[model samples]
Target chain A: MKNTILIMGHKSPDTDSICAAIAYAELKKTLGFDAKPVRLGKLNRETKYILGYFKIEEPELVTKIIEPQSEDMKQDIILVDHNEKTQTIDEADNANIIEVIDHHRIVFNTANPLYYRAEPVGSTSTIVAKIYKENGITPTKEMAGLMLSAILSDTVIFKSPTCTEEDINIAKELEKIAEVSIETYGKDMIIAGASIEGEDLADVVKTDIKLFEFGTKRLLVSQVTTAGVNKLLETKNQIIEVLEKIMKEENVDGVVLMLTDIVLEGSELLSVGKYASLIGVGFNAKVGADSVFLPGVLSRKKQIIPKLTEILI
Target chain B: MKNTILIMGHKSPDTDSICAAIAYAELKKTLGFDAKPVRLGKLNRETKYILGYFKIEEPELVTKIIEPQSEDMKQDIILVDHNEKTQTIDEADNANIIEVIDHHRIVFNTANPLYYRAEPVGSTSTIVAKIYKENGITPTKEMAGLMLSAILSDTVIFKSPTCTEEDINIAKELEKIAEVSIETYGKDMIIAGASIEGEDLADVVKTDIKLFEFGTKRLLVSQVTTAGVNKLLETKNQIIEVLEKIMKEENVDGVVLMLTDIVLEGSELLSVGKYASLIGVGFNAKVGADSVFLPGVLSRKKQIIPKLTEILI
Candidate 1:
């Protein structure tokens, strides 16, 4: 139908990105709106595990929101988790973004007014769960499970600096509804997501990346969480090669990858491309040839992006 | 204190703009925040009448949100009713927009995530009233009166095309708390605002204007609601001269004034400058030198701006 609205997150879907889209789409459907959840990219390991555990179908993948053949048709969308043009699906500039439910820095604008709800929280799922509670609609067990997983994943099991009291409260409520133990389930999910043993180095470097614009420079920042940072560093040269290719292809001034060890609560930062050394200058850490270990740096949004933005802008 | 947050509306503030800012600031204060309401420009007659009738003090007027001497000090702001940088106070770009509660097209962006709530409602007062209800805080009689008056003024007593069912419901609840009959009070406020008798033509033309950019062309759209459109038309040449001066001074491609008649429920469109004839082409009406009467056209946001944007872009 022409009125059918697509709900999606950003390209390179993570747990919160995919789960928030599905949960919000379900909320919209209960409110008598024709909505479908879609994903911009393949699901990551943790998101795949959660969806499989919950017996929820993976959202259909879509590269372009508006097709040329459907240019005259109304392609209404509701963005969740992310709002930047650089991070969304292709041809999003041509689609009608009717609503945005996000918890990230806003680099978005629209010509007409619509429903926009943003909060400085750990995850978009926190806001979505809050909305469901506000509307007096309890989520189904499957939806609750997905949302709980997303909160845990995005907040790094409540260890992230971005986590808030609201996120913890909502996660507790969702844990009860989903009949899951937060400690055991969250640990399992995080461990599952952190395993990159069989994955290609290029895909590992490409996944969970975001493009940021600072003044005149474009930078691509990527993060991969693991249980052992040294295991990933064993392939440091290969990762740097992949980063350099991505920087050239994306036409960004710099590329950075954070090899985060969840248990260690730190990240081994790898930098490549034009403005790589500025990362060390921004963080006040000595720049190694390619990498430096920053202790207690878990959040890309809070611990990394803002610092880089300050130095770059 | 450095933590004081200023809440304000756009330049040439209207009833909804001023009242919504005041009500939201009060809500923030009740929630234990250091908040103060401010206005970007002198209040229009309708807003001044509502505040005076309710015995509420007018908000402080501020031209620039940040002082150059206090550049290192935190200047946090919350915008209400409007979000476009072109319509907000001077130097808003330098201020930290911590929150935005708006009911207009979004042309706003931020580097950091914050509380942003927008809805496609008739007035910002409608959203503000809903928030008060959600938070379990009852507005005082004075605040309720101001909010009710704003809904009536912005919705043209629920006659404008932009009026929504939520506006009417919220207005009724606010009217009861305000202890005022909606019909009589709304009529008095509207009539008071519509009277342009003894006012300078230039001042009337300059009030309630918004700058819109479409495909590199900037258009200044001004609106004035009156009971007697014919009386205002008597000074059409003088109004055109003022529009011409504003067009040149603002360096805009075009300037348009919509002389709306609240009782008649129509607007007489006047155009000046380079893109003048496009207004007639956009509305499919005959362009008579400077003016064209469009019956059943009362909303600049709903009817006029979208049509002009379609033609211009």
Candidate 2:
């Protein structure tokens, strides 16, 4: 059997991570590689909905990559969306990462030189789409839809500050290819994602958590979206209790959750520990009894993370 | 008076940083931006030597960027080579950043969206050269020489793993433009940089010091090259004593200095504190009396920093 090369994103797989992996895997297969898309964690509602809508096969869920039995180590890994080892799988340290198509900060390095294409774009799927265009290999209709959905999802319909002109331009072209009205489809997709139901409060809060470290301050920011903002805010006490537990468990300086309302177009910030004033200054949100409400804030990548980094770091 | 946009690299500016600022400022001028190159710190021997060789004027030294008086705030700052606020000038945090062309990890963000182009390459000079090419601006013979020297210095004559094929290819093109042989000029440059004279023990060690923080475990690494290894080692004890003092003052966990031999192509590691075992694991150098010698180590960016990050982070 030919050794299968795994194309994967970081843990806590987001829409960009899952779609970038699937789309890049398709691109690599077109370029004659035995590549397969894989996810590090279980697919969230948004990702599952995307895969279901596109009729694309869901990628196999994997916790770690198996070490190569033979010497052709270069065919083992192709990391997407992230380059940090802390965010990646356990076996990523040993794997020969042949290519990294990411949008985040660069931290990982390789012994042998590899194809590393990292940009400060909003979505990794934006990079994957560029790779497809550069190679002159037209993506399949399913691939196009998946990639386009990833772009729209990550950029929050181009409202994110992380969205570049290239991202908007590419997304425009992709919208045509995917045959979806961006304005209408984008709202539906976001609303679909925000309609959270049937999950425990703790699981819902931890749905899309990501770790960011700026010097000694290790912060874990978890985000959840809902159409009905007040419904999620009703269970604030339970959320904060679990958040405190998670903060201690992860040995982090702080743990916070962004209860975003896609319909209302803002977020309620729930956080613990010494970072509230820092958050108050950073987010410009009015502090209330136990939480703060952020208006016109859409992106954690551009708004929340950058603000936190500036003040804390 | 027309407002001047300042283009500069990080403090303790290396050959790449200084030359990148010069090259990028030139590129921006060709595109008709009222830009002037500036240096945050005094130029090192290698940088001074390169500017002298090319007959290009050294940039005006600037310790801080002044606040904008009126409306045109975007023209205040244009950062190159580095994006971290810790590495940049004091006023950069408050200034309106118009653009950034860097090759390091992304850390800084602005209130308004701006032009940011960051690539994972060996040197920021390489990025500047490519920017010139992209804009269809032909560099002068002197500019080519300065940029070529920057690349060679940053990559240590293409022996660094950070050097991509694009760097080697661009350097080849630059050599023809500059009318100099790469092999001879590269060695001459390295040898000249290694000939450290008329500096005290503490200054010698602190000349190229950079602070790196992996969470709370802050580290200060100082690298100095010399032709004669024994010349640097003679004052190792005094260096260690000062390094310990500096570490405590800076509140860093460890301090290490790499006494690299340019001709011999190796480094004798002198360290103070608990990170020695981490370094021992990192470098595989046998810890001798207050120092360990490692053979065939040319580039600290590739060999030293990555290993230390792995062990510490």
Number of the predicted model whose DockQ against the real structure is largest: 1
Candidate 1 residue pairs that clash: none
Candidate 2, residues B1-313: lDDT per residue as tens digits?
Answer: 5578889898988888888888888888888888899999888888888898888898998897566566655347788887777899887655667777777756654444455566667877887887777556788888898889988987778876678898898899889998899999988887788776775667777888888887678889888877788876787677789888888887888998888876677888877778766676566655455678888776667778787788888
TM-score of 1: 0.85
DockQ metric for all predictions: 0.69, 0.05
lDDT of 2 at B148: 94
RMSD of 2: 9.7
DockQ, cand. 2: 0.05
Tens-digit lDDT string for candidate 1 (A1-313) = 5768999998888899999999999999999999999999889998888998999999998899555456557589999998889889898877888999999887777877899999999999999998888778999999999999999998988989989999999999999999999999998888889898788887887787878888998888998888788877887788888999988888889998998887788999888877787777676667456688899999888788888889888
- Candidate 2's docking class is incorrect
Clashing pairs in 2: none
TM-score (0 to 1) for chain B of model 2:
0.88
In model 1, where do residues sit more than 4 Å from their true spots? A68-72, A209-221, A228-257, A268-294, A304-313, B68-72, B210-221, B228-257, B268-294, B305-313
Q: Write the per-residue lDDT of candidate 2 for residues A62-93, one digit (tens) a residue.
A: 89756656666534788899877788977766
